[model samples]
Target: MTTTVINHIHETTTATTTTSQTQSPPSPTTTPPHHHKQPPPRDHHCNHHH
Candidate 1:
């Protein structure tokens, strides 16, 4: 009986820890800055697509 109670407590603690770790990583929102980095314009606009 005592061993069963201890095992249950250990299982609950491990499960809670795993869940907290999984949820923490997704909180940091990643803002991509690469969109602002565009190639420099040429002296003469030669068929500039964009």
Candidate 2:
């Protein structure tokens, strides 16, 4: 189902953006950090908490 792909993307993108590049962008305009930060607690808390 399409939901499966969306879930996979949500996990992978947030995980990579967080762990792979802590210092990803110095600009506050970049949304990657915001997206990464929000998902850890909402959708991927278990994944990151591990």
Candidate 3:
């Protein structure tokens, strides 16, 4: 019974992992090139003013 339960859980975990990998490509949507570059420019301007 214990082994069966473990196997079932493992199978479920593997399925979920595969689903997660498939969904991973959209993660780059959160990272915009302009958004990343904006912060460094702000920091440089702040230091120049100081």
Candidate 4:
């Protein structure tokens, strides 16, 4: 009777804790930084006069 109730409580607490831990968001340090897209290369034209 009492033992069964206590066991049920313990199981519920354990399950709640495990769920909360798993659902928690990851830390910032674990995520990668966002980078901007690179610009296209430019063309250069040179004229020589002698």
lDDT of 4 by residue, 27-50 (tens): 322332211222221112222221
lDDT of 2: 0.74
Off by over 4 Å in 2: 23-50
- Tens digit of lDDT per residue, candidate 1, span 1-50? 99999999999988877876675444422222332343443323454753
Q: Clash pairs of candidate 2?
A: none
Model 4's alpha-carbon lDDT is 0.54
> Could you give the candidate ranking by lDDT, starting with the highest?
3, 2, 1, 4
Instruction: Please give me the total number of clashing residue pairs in predicted model 2.
Output: 0
Q: What's the TM-score of each model vs. the native?
A: 0.44, 0.41, 0.44, 0.44
User: TM-score for model 1?
Assistant: 0.44
RMSD of 4: 14.3
lDDT of 2 at 20: 55
Backbone N/Cα/C clashes per model: 0, 0, 0, 0
TM for candidate 2 is 0.41
User: Which one wins on lDDT?
Assistant: 3
Itemize residue pairs with steric clashes in candidate 3: none
C-alpha lDDT of all candidate models, in order: 0.59, 0.74, 0.77, 0.54
